[model samples]
Structure formats: structure tokens, C-alpha cells
Target: MTSEAKETGSGLTAELKELCQAVSEDFAMLASLHNKEPDAELLRLLRDERFPEGLGLRLVEERGAQAVAFMQRALSALPDQMGQADLDELAADYADIYLNHGIQASPLESVWTDDENLVCQDSMFQVREWYQQHGLMSTDWRIIPDDHLVLQLQFLSHLFAAGKTMDDLREIARFMDEHLLRWLTSFAERVAGRCATPYFAGIALLTGAYSEELRELLVSILDEPRPSPEEIEDKMRPRRVEEPVEVKFMPGMGPVV
Candidate 1:
């Protein structure tokens, strides 16, 4: 290659690396917000004037101004100095939205994708397989299913941070198409509608918008066209069918052969 061509390639690689780092950080932030109730450290960060603006600028560059606007509104609604009552309210909102048995909005992918709207379904196992392929697994599937939104976000963060080649970007894109993008928008919408706090609602909107924009970015980087909804559904269709088993009972005793 010419010297100029080499320079161009180097520049592009540096730019992509920077973008990946930023994207990874963004995913980590989203994961942290969703993982639990707001703690003092988080509240302190929210109170810091630079935090929202910095985050907003990064988001607006990829997503649009509307994404930043939602976040600003939510942050503005928070008390200048949070007290016990404020913390309690936030905790309750989190529980109602994510933790409660009668959760208003579940963060598990299987709950949204399964036919019966239950957790620990086929999607959870599929996501576990994805994790295992990367030499990672949840500490306990019983406590936190593999397809939980927080875990999925953390996985994307890991992928971006470790991604080194076009193949890695393709894998990230494929994972989002197969997993995150499939149910994230619906989950965000549900959270927005059901959550009491503007904070959760705003984050939901921002996260959904960010994921869509990130997918577009990956497509641009890889020079690949995104699949349509129908195409994705076809791709995601179950690959195996289980056959039924018949059992015969006799008058003296139940028997199966």
C-alpha cells in the first residue's frame, strides 16, 4: 500500500477504537443504572453538572437531540440533595419496575419474547449459550437469568471493549439483532409507561434510542445492510422441534415401553 493509504488505514483504526471505547462506557453506564437503585455515588454523579452534559453530548452525537432532552428532563426532576424519603421512593420505583414478582416491567428478555411471557424460558438458555461461547457465565442463573437486560448490556460492553477486528463488530451486530434489539424497545416502552420515576423512564428512552443508533453505526462500519424485521424473525426461528412421547397404562400397573 502507498504511504498515504497506510496513514488513512491507521487513522481509521484509531477512530474506530475511540468510538468503541465510548460505546463501551455508555453501555456500562446503562447497565449500572438498571442494575439497582440509585446509590449515593450515583446521586452525586447526577448532581454534578458536567455528568449529564457530557453524557448528553456523547448521546446527541450518535442519537439525536431528543435523546439528550429526555435525559435532561429526568435529571432535572431529581432533588438537588436527595434525602432518605427520596431514596426510598426511588427504591420503591425500582422494585415495582424490576424486582417485584408482580413487576410492572420486567428486565428479562424471555419475559418479553416467550409465548407465555415468563422468565427463564428458551431465550434465557439461548443467551446463556452465547455467554458460554465467550467463556463467560452468570454466577447463578436462578438469581439472575442470562437474558436479563443488565447482563445483556454488560455483555455488549464487554464485546465492544474487547473487539479488535471487523469480525468482532459483525459479531456484536449479530448479537444485538438476535438478542437485545429484539425486545429492548418493547421493554423500554413498558418501563416508560409503568415506572413512577421520570429517571427510569428517561433512561429507558435513551437506552432504546442509543441501541438503535449503535446498530446503525455498526452497519456503517461493517458496510452491511441491517436485516428487516421479517428477516430477523426468520433468522431467529427455533431450529429444533421436540416430538411427543406416548405412554400406555395397563389395568394392573402403569407401563411404558
Candidate 2:
């Protein structure tokens, strides 16, 4: 290759790496926000001008722009000097949305995807299998199912940070298409509509938009077309046919045969 070509290739590699790092950090931040109630440290971080500026820059598309605007508005609603009362209110809102049994919005993939709207269902097991394929496992699956939003976001962060090749990006794209993208938009809309605090509502919108943008970014980087939602659904649907089982009965319950 020409020296100019080599320089271009190197520059592109550097740019891709920077992009992955930024995306990884963004996922980690979102995971942290959903993992627990906001504390003083988190509150301070949100209020920092750099936070919004950096996020706004990263989220430049139309959907992402809306998310950034909502988040900025929410942040602006916070007190300049946060007090215990402020923290308590935020905590309560968090609990109402994330911790309550009758939560307005659930943060589990199964809840949104399952027909019965239950947790710890087939989707959770499927997600667990995906983690195992990656040689990764959640620290406590009992407490938090494998398909929980926080864990999934953390997994994406891990994937982006560790991904270095086109194949790795492909895997990330596949995982997002198969899992997070399936229900994230619905979850985001629910949270945005029902959450008591504007912060979480903003976060919900941001997370949804960011995931969409990130998926598009991956498509651009990999130079591959993303499958439609219907295509993904058809691919994921079960195609297995079970064999008929011979009927056996207890002596007392047996019919004349």
C-alpha cells in the first residue's frame, strides 16, 4: 500500500477506536443511572455542564437531539444547590419507577417482550445464553435476571470497549438487534410517560435514542445493512416441531384399550 493509504488506514482505525470508547462510556453512564437511586455524586455529575455538552455532541441525530433536549430540561429543573430533600425526592421517584412491585415502568426485557408480561421468562434465559456465549455471566442472576435493562446496558458497554475488529462489531450489532432493540423503545416510552421525575423520563428517552443511533453507527462502521424488525422477529421465532409422545396412564386412570 502507498504511504498515504497507510496513513489513511491508521487514521480510520484511531477514529473507530475513539468512537468505541465514547460509546462504551455512554452505555456505562446509562447503566449507572439505572442501577440505583441518584446520590449527591451522581446529581453533581448530571449538573456539570460538561455532561450535557458531551452527550449533546454524541447524540446529534433527530431522535437523539430530542433526547438531549429533554435531559437538559430535566437537569435544569434540579436545584443549583441540592439539599437532602432534593435527594430524597429523587430517590423516591427512582423507587417508584424501578423498585416498586407495581412499577409504572419495568426495566426488564422479558416484561416487555413476553406475552404474559412477566419477568424471568424465556427472554431472560435467552439473554443468559448470550452472556455465556461471550464467557460472561451476571454476578447475581437471582437478584437481577439476565435480561434486566441495567445488566444488558453494562454488557453492551463491555462489548464496545473490548471490540476491536469488524467481527466484534458485527457481534455487537447482532446482540443489540436481537435483544435490546426489541423492547427498549417501548420501555423508554413507558418510563417517559409515567415516571414521577423528569430525570428518569429524560433518561428513558436518551437511552432509547442512543441505542438506535449506536446501532446505526455500527452499521456505518461495518458497512452492513441492519435487518428490519420484522426480519429479526422471524429469525428469532421458534421453528422446532415436537414429536408426539405416547400416552401412558396410571392403572386406576387407564381407559379401556
Candidate 3:
């Protein structure tokens, strides 16, 4: 390639990578939002402070006035500071929606996909394998299943942040198509329908829309169509019977034993 052409190609790749990273950050935040109640720091980012170059701002700009207005309404609903009563109320809502023995919108991938709607099933195994292949694992996998919504989103963020090769990007594209896209829209709908709190409901709506937008961006970068949910399920089926492999710890992933 000519020097100028090479430079242009490099610029495009950098832009794509940056876009992935931005989406990753947003997913990371959203994932954290559902995993627990809004803390002081998150409330500040959502309500008090401004991030001129932040993902939320960028989403509003790209997604238009409706998005801007929706976010404004959501932010307005959040308290500037959580008092004892507010925290307890949020905790109750979190449990009713996400925990407390049985919730309306279960976060496990298997629950959304499998006929039995079980946890720690084939989906969890496949997700764990995917993480191991990429030299990663969740420290909390013992307490929570590998295919929990938060962990899956965290895995995506890790992929975008760490990926440097076309192969890496391809993996990310496959992951989104096969895993997240299959169920996230429905999950969002469930949350919208079931969650009483405006905050959680807004999170569901935002996550669903943002993930779809991110997928579209990935399709453009990949220059190909994403696989259907059925196709993904078929492809993932055989891996379930495979023997589990020993996992290795990677640097910056966590502390080694």
C-alpha cells in the first residue's frame, strides 16, 4: 500500500476501535447499574456533572432529540443524593426486579434461551469457554453464573478494550450477534414491563437501543451480516458436551494464586 493509503487505513481502524471502546464503556456502566443500586459516583455522572466527550453525550447527539429528552427525564428522576430511605427503596426494587429468589427478568442467558429456562446450563459453559479462550475469567463466576447479563457485557467491554487484531474484532462481532443480540431486546422489554422504578426501566430502554446501535456499527465495520439467533444456537450446541479445560490467569485480569 502507498504511504498515504496506509495512513488512511490506519486512521479508519483507529476510529472503529475507538467507537467500540466507547460502546464498551457505556455497556460497562449500564451493566453495573443493574448489578446494584446507583451509588454516589454513578449518580454524579448521570445527574450532577457533565462529560462533553462522554458516551452518553455522544449517544444523544447521534440518536437525536428523542434520546436527549428521554435521558433528561431519566436523569431528572434520579435523586441528587440517596438518603437512607431512598437507598432502601432502591434496594427493594432491585431485589424485586433482579433478585429475591425469583424475578421477572432473570439476567442469566440460559433462562432467556433454554426451553427449561435453567441457570448454569449450556450457555454458561459456552460463555466460560469463550472467556478462557481469550485469557479471561470472571472472579465472581462462583457466586454468579458465567452468563449473567453483567458478566456478558463486561466481557464485551474487555474485548473492545483489549482487542488489537482483525481476529479480535471478528470475535467481538460474533459474540454480540450470537450471545447478546439474541435476547437483549426481549430482556429490555421485560424490564420495561416489570420494573416499577423509572431508573431501572430507563436503563432497560437505553441498553436495548444502545446495543442495537452498536451492532449496526459493528456490521458496517465488519462488512457482513450478523448470524440469526437460530444459527447461533445451532453453532453453540456442540460445544456444550466438550470437556472443560483448566484455566490460566492472565496479567491485569486479576491476581494470580
Candidate 4:
């Protein structure tokens, strides 16, 4: 590659890292807001932006689609507009779905990963390693679990700040390809049909969108040596449920042959 090409590649990589930071920060803010009810000003903004006239409506609609897709798997997915009673009901239902089904709906590592055997290298398993390597513990202060998307975003945030070497950038890129984006697509697909509420449904849709953008940005940073873009397909495998898996139940956690 010419010196100019090298400089361009470096520039692209920097842009990709910045994109990752943007998406991560967006989700981190969301995770915080999810735990707390927004004040009147925020609520007014949400309502206005959600209405037909707001200029940024498409972004909201696109994200809404992702959320509904995620929730429609198990429940009667609805639109964003709902009364206070509906909101309460939806929240309660979501809580139950999360509690009763647990891993059945979303599996943390240990599921679909055979890291213990040392013969396979699932990206999800790699994320666990990354967390421990960075000394990110799962204490109560952490709002999300160890493997949640929000936490992964936080990890990337830390990486972006401490990044000083090309090796650091490469490591971060590897983490994105192997871990965060690797399993999240499949994970989101599984979640799409699990909920009935439009709110979470919107979340799922936006979640997938966010995941797609993040993955593309990371892969772009990778700059494949020979393989063309056409060769790459979706990064996740389709999940099948034989029995009616309960909440919290995860697949592929047992011993690998």
C-alpha cells in the first residue's frame, strides 16, 4: 500500500472507533434512563419526537420497528403510544418474561460456548475473557450483567480512552468481531418473538440496528486482506427450541463432545 493509502486506512480505522463510541454511549445513556423515570422535560421531548411532525421521526420509527420485532416473538406487539396503565402492564409483563424464562429468552455465555474444552472459540466466550482481563467485575454497582450489551459498550468506552497502540486498536476490533456483534444478532433474533409490548419491541428493533452499525464499523476497521464484502453473510446462527424452554434456561451449556 502507498503511504497515502496507509494514511487513509488509518483514518477509516479512527472513524470506526469513533462510531463505536457513539453507539456505546447512546446505549449507556439508555441503560441509565431505563432504570429511572424521565422528568417532565425529557418526557415531553420523547412524546414530541415520537409524534408524526418531529423531524427526527424516522430514526425513532426505525428503532421502533426493531423493538417491536424483538417483542413480537412472544407477545402482542403494539405501537409506541400507550396509556399509563398499558405502560405499567407492559413493564410488569416484561419483568415476568425476564424472570420466568431467564436464559430461555437470552443466554449468557456458558450456553453455545465450549471454551472449557479449548477446542472451540465462540465469540461469546471470548467476551467473558475480555471482561476478566480488564478487571471488570459484576458487582451490584453495575446496572447491567457481565455479558449485557451495555456492559460491552462500557468496555469499549474504556478501550477507546486507554487506546495508545495499533495493537490496542486491533485488539478492540477483534473483540467487536468475535464477541459483541458475533452473538448479538442471533441473540436479538431470538428475542424478537419473545415479548408482546411495543416498547421493548422498539428496543429490540433499535438494538438490532445499533448492532448492525456497530458490527459494520468494527469489520470496516478490520479491512479484510483478501475476502470481499459480498462473501460475508450474517454473523449469527439460527437458534432452535426443541422444548418450550423456560425463562433463564440457556442452550449448549453442557459438556461438549
Candidate 5:
């Protein structure tokens, strides 16, 4: 790698480490929604409007709105249903969209590009190679072929949180720009449009919100500017794109000790 590329890679890796650290906290709070039954404390917290934190609460609310909007439009598109049949059919239909219908490919920049391997071409491969170089390997849950989105975010969060070198920040920023930010905004919007429940809707909104924050941080590091909340609006606009230099990983890589 060139000197500049090395610097950028290290910087970005550090940022990803930081983000990976936050994943635990973020997921801990968000996963509360999955509780099978709510007790008095949970009920009280939800009723008091104090369960979700500031940004999280806002994200949740936006998701709720998006969900309702999607459901309303979807309901309008379908033939009329009886009162009892309405919710069951809607739920079934919504589940079908994600599970049965084919989803876009993962870990492929080409999926997001109209052209062949545009931004950060083979950059993901570089990342995979980087993982091996650093003595890191994908976990059982995060297999090589296709890692889950949530796991990827969590890993990045922790990586960025612990890693603070300038070299690490740059690499992570580029990764965020070329990979995560490049597609998450549209994905979130599409998810919002498709979901029929406030629970799922909120997840979509939260995804976009987090992506915005990550993009700002990445840009700030790349340009040597301080990222602010106001700077995140730029995510909606297109900017100059960069291609990742090719890097290779040996087979049967193991996790960093």
C-alpha cells in the first residue's frame, strides 16, 4: 500500500473500532423491544416516555411514522378486507416481502452501482484481507459469504471506539463512505416504505440515522475537518467517490488474538 493509503486505512479502522464499542450499548437498549412479556417496570418506563434515549427516541418516532405511512399506502393498494382479516393479511404480506422475495446482494459494491465495480472496487475484499492481516477472522455468526448487517455495524462500532490513531480513522472513514453510507440511506428508505409495524419502521429509521452520523465522522476525518451534527445533511447529496485499492487475503484466516 502507498503511504497515504496506509494512513487512511489505519484511521478508518480505528473509527470502526470505536463504533463497534458503541454497538453493545446501542443493541442492549434497542433489543428491549423483543421482550416476550412486559412487567410493571417496563410498562412504567414505556408509559413514562423515558425508555428510549434522545436520539434513539427520535429515531424510533420517525420509524413509527414511516411504518404507518407504508401500511396506509399498502392497505390502499389491496382489495378490501374484513376487520379480523386485515391485520393478519397485512402481517403475512409484510413478512413475505423480506423472506420470500429476493434481497439485494451483500458485500458487493456492484449491487449499488449502475456501473461495474465503481466506488471502492474490491475495497471490501481489502477489508477482508485487512481482517486477516490484523489476525482477525469472521465469527461463526459472521461467516465469510454473507455477514448480517447488525453484526457488521456492531463490529465497526467497537473497532472505531478503541482505535484512535489517525491511520485507523482514515481507513474507517473511507469504508464508511464507500460501503455503509453508500447504500444504507436508500436501504433504510426502502425498508421504511415496506414495513407495516412501528417496531420494524423504527429499525429502518434508526439505520438511516446511524448511517448519517457515520458518514459525517468519515468525511470529517478524510478532509481534516471536525464533524458536526449539521454536516450530516450532506448525506442526501452526492459527492466525489473513491475506489479502494486492491488487497488480498490468504484463505482460512483466523481472528486476531
Candidate 6:
């Protein structure tokens, strides 16, 4: 390749790396926010102009206009006449939705996946193994399950920020496809239905949409070059039909195939 072509390719790689890192940080921060009560400092951060514009605008472009509009409204609400009572109400909403017994929406992946709707099941252990494979061991494992929403998203942030190799990209694709993407959409939908505040509902929408967008982004990044003519013909050649077989289910694991 020409020097100019090489330089352009390198520049594009750098830009994509930076994009991944930025989105990773966004996910990490937002995930951390939902893990606890909203303090005054957290409220201040939300009201800050820098809080939403970058990721929010990008999400609008990728996801849709409606959720971003709701998100902006949530941020706008931050500066409104929120007295201590109002703040307490907001915090209460968070606790009721995320922390209460028999909550409408549990943030654990296994809860949404298992027939029993339990936590710390197979999916949780699977996610924990994936984390350890990537040099992450949960410091909160004594209290927090490895597959808590915050931990899962935090792990995704690390994956994206650290993803530069083809293997890294492939690992992320498998992890999301087999884990987070499997359950987060349902979890987000529940959050939208249950959350009293747009702050959290917007967060739900943002999390689901952003994960989807990143999955697509990684797919594009990992796209293979055109197949050889022989390979193309082999794929194009007609195959004999086979009888359908009975299938057993593996919850949250997609098709057994």
C-alpha cells in the first residue's frame, strides 16, 4: 500500500479505539450511577452540560429520537425545584426498583433468563468465568453477584476500552451475544415500565440501545474480506433437505446449535 493509504488506515484505527474508550467510560459511569442512591453530587453531575451531549447525541443518531428526548427531559428535571423531599422520592424509586424484595425488575441476568427467575445461577457463573479470562475478578463478589447489571456493564466498558485485537473483538461479540444482549433488553423494558423517574427510564433505554449499537459496530469492525470464488460456489451449491429434529432448550444460551 501507498504511504498515504497506510497513514489513513492507522488514523482510522486510532479514531475507532478512542471511540470505544469514550463509550466504555459512558457505560461505566452510567452503570455505576444505577448501583446506588442518587446523591447531590450525582445530581450535579447529571445537570452538568457535559453529562449527556456526547453519548446522548450519538445514541440519538444510532437508536432513535424518543429515548434521547426522554433522557434530555430527565437531565432538565435535575435543575428543577427538587427539594429534599423530591430527592428522597427519587432515591426511593431507585431502591424500590433495584433493591427491594420481589422487585418488578431484577437487574441480574439470571433472573431474566432462568425459568425460576433466580439470581447467581449458571449465567452468573458463566459471566464470572468470562471476567476472569479477561483478568477481572469481582471485588464485590462476597455481596454482589458477578452478573449484576453494574458489574456486567462495567465489564463491557473494560472490554471495549481494551479491545484492539481481533480476539478481543470476538470475545466481546460472544460475551454480549451469549450474555448481556440476551437479557438486558428485557431488563431495560422492565425498567421503563417500572421506573417512576425518566432519569432511570432513560438510562434503561440508553443501556439497551448502546449495547446493541456497539454489537453492530463490532460486527462491522470484524467483517471478513470477500470469500474466494470456490468458497462462494460451495456455499451457493444446493444442499439436501434433512428431517427436522426435536430440540431441547437451554435458557439464555440461545439455540443449542
- Find the candidate with the highest lDDT and give its number: 2
Residue-wise lDDT of candidate 1 within 141-171, one digit each (tens)? 7888899999999998887777777777888
Task: Sort all candidates by TM-score, best to worst.
Answer: 2, 1, 3, 6, 4, 5
For each candidate in turn, the TM-score is: 0.84, 0.86, 0.78, 0.55, 0.48, 0.77
**lDDT at 83, model 1:** 89
Cα misplacement distance, residue 36 of candidate 2 (Å): 0.9
Each model's Cα RMSD: 7.4, 6.9, 13.3, 12.8, 14.3, 11.4
**How well does model 3 score by local distance difference test?**
0.70
Candidate 2 clashing pairs, residues 3+ apart or interchain: none
lDDT of 2 by residue, 36-116 (tens): 988877777777854556752287899988888888889888887889998888888888877784455788888877778
Q: Write the per-residue lDDT of candidate 3 for residues 184-257, one digit (tens) a residue.
A: 88887887677767667677767777777777766767788877777887886644476766677997896453
- The number of the candidate with the highest TM-score is 2
Which order, best to worst by lDDT? 2, 1, 6, 3, 4, 5
Off by over 4 Å in 6: 1-12, 60-62, 79-81, 224-257
**Ten contiguous residues with the weakest lDDT in model 5:** 1-10
Cα lDDT tens digits, model 6, 1-257, are 00111111122367677776787887777788778877777777677764566672175344645666777788787755567887887788888777883348988887877668888777788888888766787787657788888888888788776777666667777777777887788888888887788888888887787777667776777783333435533443335699898776797876664
**lDDT at position 257, candidate 2:** 29
Worst 10 residues of 6 by lDDT: 1-10
lDDT by candidate, in order shown: 0.79, 0.81, 0.70, 0.48, 0.45, 0.72
Off by over 4 Å in 2: 1-12, 239-257
Off by over 4 Å in 1: 1-12, 49-52, 61-64, 101-103, 239-257
**Candidate 4 residue-wise lDDT, 1-257, digit = tens:** 00111111233356545554555455554444333333344444555554212312123345554453443332323334556776566556456434344325542432433335222235444565676676555453234345555556567666654554556667766666555655565655655556654554444455556555544444555564422323222333324458854455348675333
Looking at model 1, the pairs that clash are none
| Residue pair clashes in candidate 3 | none
Q: Name the better of 3 and 5 by lDDT.
A: 3
